[model samples]
Structure formats: C-alpha cells, structure tokens
Target: MSMTSDIYKTIAKKSPESLFKDRGSKFIGQAHPVKEEAEIERILTELKNKHSKASHICYAWQLGKNYEHYRANDDGEPNNSAGLPIYGQLQSFEVTQILVTVIRYYGGTNLGVGGLIQAYKTAAQLALESANIKTKVITEALQIDFEYALLHTVMRIIKEEQISVTSQKMELSCSITLAIRKKDLNSIKKRFDAVFGLTVITENF
Candidate 1:
C-alpha cells in the first residue's frame, strides 16, 4: 500500500521500552523529518544505501486519512511481511507526519510470519519513540494590513494574542500575514476590527 493521507506531525527522539529483541535479526530503526514527498524519497534512498546488505527494509508513513493514506512498503521481503507491521505500529501510537525506516540485518534464518511481525514491530516502535516530535494544525494566508505607524502594534498584538504572524513585508502599507488557526479565525477578525478598524480580510490566498 501507499500513504496519501494528510496528517502533520514530527518524529520523536526517544527509544521504546522492552527487551523485545527477537534475534535471528538485527534491526536499526531511524525516524526522519519529512515535510515533502521529495524529502521522503531522499531519506529512503540514503537509508537504503547505508544498509545495503540488510535482508529487507520495510517502511511506512502516515499522511492523513486511511486507505493508502497509510503507506507501507515491503521492500524485498515477503508480501505483507515488512511494511504492514510497521504501519500497524505507527497507527498504534497515533503518530502522523512521520517516516520510519527499519533496516534489517538478517540472521541466517527466516523469522517466518510471527517472528517477522515481532521484529518489525519492535523496530518501528523503537524508531518512533526516539523521534520525539511535535506538530500543530496550520492554515495558510491571512492578510492584515495597516499604516506604518501601527505595524509594531499589530505585530505586538499578534504575538501577545498567540496569533502566528507569518509574514511582515510589503510596500506602502505595513502588511502582515498570519497563519491563522482554523478555530481562531473569528477571534482574529474581531481583534482586527478592534485594533485596526479598517482592517481588510481576503481569502485570495
């Protein structure tokens, strides 16, 4: 399967708990920051090359929805052996916007289905915990403009009110753009009215 979901999150940087190493295989799990598809490809390539001799490399990433929104790849392992287990571990932790690559240095034996599942699950679990990440729901483009005299005031208000002012550059007027949270749109509008009276609101972006 493939990941096409749209959830946003960061990776954790801590490892997991348990002596859950089922031998026969050595696993190294790594968590990565991937904000775009190209970056994801880059990371996968780097890891694949790094552990070129690993028996199998399975990975998964959670985007947003379900279906293929959850993506997993078996690499060169048995079908459903590598990726699905990793995907399950991610889902178990409710972590999104994360990429996990599990490199397996195979022992001279086959882990069968059960053994393979445990090994993969353990690797994914460890990698995810180590990532230690955070994320917030973000929206794009809210333009708040005012005369130059009030630019500082606007910026101050935005900061004090916990609004994220994303941009503050433009000509003639002191222009500001904030990454307005979906829930705070109305509140921002009201404050805009209170402070800047003639504030303009546009959904052009």
Candidate 2:
C-alpha cells in the first residue's frame, strides 16, 4: 500500500493457539489484534502467567496505520533467532496493529540458531494463517457548527454522503461531530465548506 493510503490490514481477533515442534522442543504461537502500546504489556503479562513453565516468550508487534511503529523481543533466545523470524511474518502478511508471540518449552534439546529461527517462523506463520484478517480505513473527526435553521440542509448532505454523525448538539446554534474516512476528507470538507453559514473544523484524534 502507498504511504498516503488510509487502508490497513489487521487481525480481527485473537487467534487460536498454534503449535510447532522441532528437536523435541515445543513452540506455541498466537496472534492478537491490538490497538495501543498499553495493550501489549497486559497481553504479555497474561501469557507469561499462563505459561509460567515455558522457557522463552518471544514476541513482535506492529502498530499505526502506516505501520510506522514496531518492536521485536527475543526473550532469552539467541539474538535474532526467535523474535526477528517471528517479526518477518508480520511484514510478510502486511499487517499492522497486531502482535504475535511464541512460547517455547524446552524438550531437553538445544536447536541451534538456524533451527530456532525456522521453528519460530513456522509457528508464527501458522498462528497468522489461522487468524481472521480484516481491512480497515483510518478515520478523522470533524466538527461542524451551524445555525439551527441550516440543520435540514446539513442533515440532507449527511444522509446523501453516508457520513457518520458521532455526536450532535441541537440548539439555536448547533454543533456536530462527524467521523470521516481519511481518504474522503478533502472532498467532504469541500462540500461542507460550500454551505454558506456552515463552519467545519478538523479535530485531532
């Protein structure tokens, strides 16, 4: 997707756990759809508690509509063996606002770096493949202020354009907040601007 595009891909929900085994070691993988950085810690804490006996809990996450933010953690595994390979799956799938974690259970065998990479990558791939992927559009909030007399005109435009009214205050002077798709902002803004007595302001999310 283009840098300017407002469309993005993300998992719809938490994926069912996936398992991979190599050299007697077990790797458990899961994918989660997360919106904010704060959610990551809570998820990790829960996973750590659930699999307290696991050897390593490696993970990777990508956030933002442009996929501008990301993190990868190898836990106690060798360097890039675990985390980087898992992260590669996120890029390969072109998904953002998601996290993939791999839990390892030592089976009395040491799979060197190469084996670890393959194991983690395969586990993460399986988790994602079982997930429900979805496409989403980034949206911006817009505030419109106009006199009550112009309410009908505004409502007409809103209905015709299929704009979502997030909130509205009806009085002599009325105010409304609209959720607009980022891609359609310019054209929609221009249409509202043409209304003689209407004022439109973009609100920062």
Candidate 3:
C-alpha cells in the first residue's frame, strides 16, 4: 500500500572549497516537518536574527510539490547568483521542508556573476554536510501497564529493542505507549510473555 506521508531526515552535508578566494560563503541547513506555516517563518526569523550583520542573506525553502512556490532574495548581490544556486543544491538532493540561507561578507575583491554563483553554491554545500538524514517507518502503538517491580524489566527491553515508547505513567503501575512495526510483533510478544509471563494491550496510532 502507498502511504500518504513518509518521514525523512538529512544524512550528510556537502560543501567544497572554491578557488574563488574573492568570495566567502556560509551555509545553514536544518530539517523541518511540514505541519504548520509558522514553523517555516520562525526558522527564517532565527536565521536572520543570527546573521543580522551579514552583507546579504539569501535563502530557499521546499515545502511540497509546488517547490517554485518559494522565494529567495539575493539581498544585494548581482541578480540570480546568490539564491538560485542554493535552491539548485536542494533540488539535486531531492530534499523538502528545508530552508538554506547563505550569508556572504564580501571580500575586498568582487566575484562577478560566475564567481557569485560559485560562492553561494559552495556555502549551501557546506551547510548541507552538517545535517543527519533519517527515513521514518510506520509502526503501531502499544500500551503496557505493569507494577513498579516489572516496569524496570519492560523498560529495559524497550531500551534494548527497536521499539520506541511515546508516553508513560509511573504510579502504582507503569502505563506506557510504544510504537512498534507490525513485522516485529511476534518477537516482542514472545519477549514480553517470557519476562512478565502474561499478555498486554495495544491501541492503534
């Protein structure tokens, strides 16, 4: 079956040095979920605030199939050189919901149109390397409740396995909500059955 949404993360960043010494560049890449519009604006604000003194701040963001729906400001650099290069890099990597901004502090010398393009591209490449990428997998939600004594055992297994517990309560009994893949159900069931010597309850996510 085709899932409506798939989670993804940045794995590695790519930035290479340029012989164009007259130009200096900086790259900042961050992963974001497309759940809300405010999230994008907030990140952009943070970038601007961080590099308030830079000569120019050029950026691009990908949110959905309509990628061209984004805007980039060359700030003051020659026309398309600054922002487009950064956007090109994102397209090459097939990334989305990511905003990359390149801050440039002009060296006394000027990098004409070609040089400016290389400089901005180089900056975005550097930021790309700093991110870690990951792919999300679908899993079911399982809830478990056990006495304090047995809670430790359950937690231990959870920590050691691929399952991730999303919530929990620890008063007389520890009630936990965990996320697990369907394929691993039998194995987890066996382990729990052996440890607690009983069955547990589960709920759909």
For residues 104-130, write the lDDT of model 2, one tens digit per residue: 999998889999999999999999999
Q: Is candidate 1 or candidate 3 better by lDDT?
A: 1
- List of clashing residue pairs for candidate 3: 9-133, 9-134, 10-132, 10-133, 11-133, 13-128, 13-129, 14-125, 14-129, 15-125
lDDT of the candidates, in the order given:
0.69, 0.94, 0.63
Residue pairs that clash (backbone atoms under 3 angstroms), model 2: none
Candidate with best lDDT: 2
lDDT of 3 by residue, 1-205 (tens): 1224333333333233222234343333333334345766786687678868767767766654323345566877888888888878776666655666676655566667998888777766666655454444446677776787887788788988967878888887678888887667667867887864334776645
Task: Please identify which of the two predictions, 2 or 3, would achieve the higher TM-score against the true structure.
Answer: 2
Candidate 3, residue 133: the lDDT equals 42
- Model 2: C-alpha RMSD to truth? 1.6
Clashes in candidate 2: how many? 0
- For all predictions, the C-alpha RMSD in Å is 5.1, 1.6, 7.4
Instruction: Give me the overall lDDT of model 3.
Output: 0.63
Q: Indicate the residue-level lDDT of 25 in model 1.
A: 70
How do all the candidates rank in terms of TM-score, highest first? Answer: 2, 1, 3
Q: What is the TM-score of candidate 3? A: 0.52
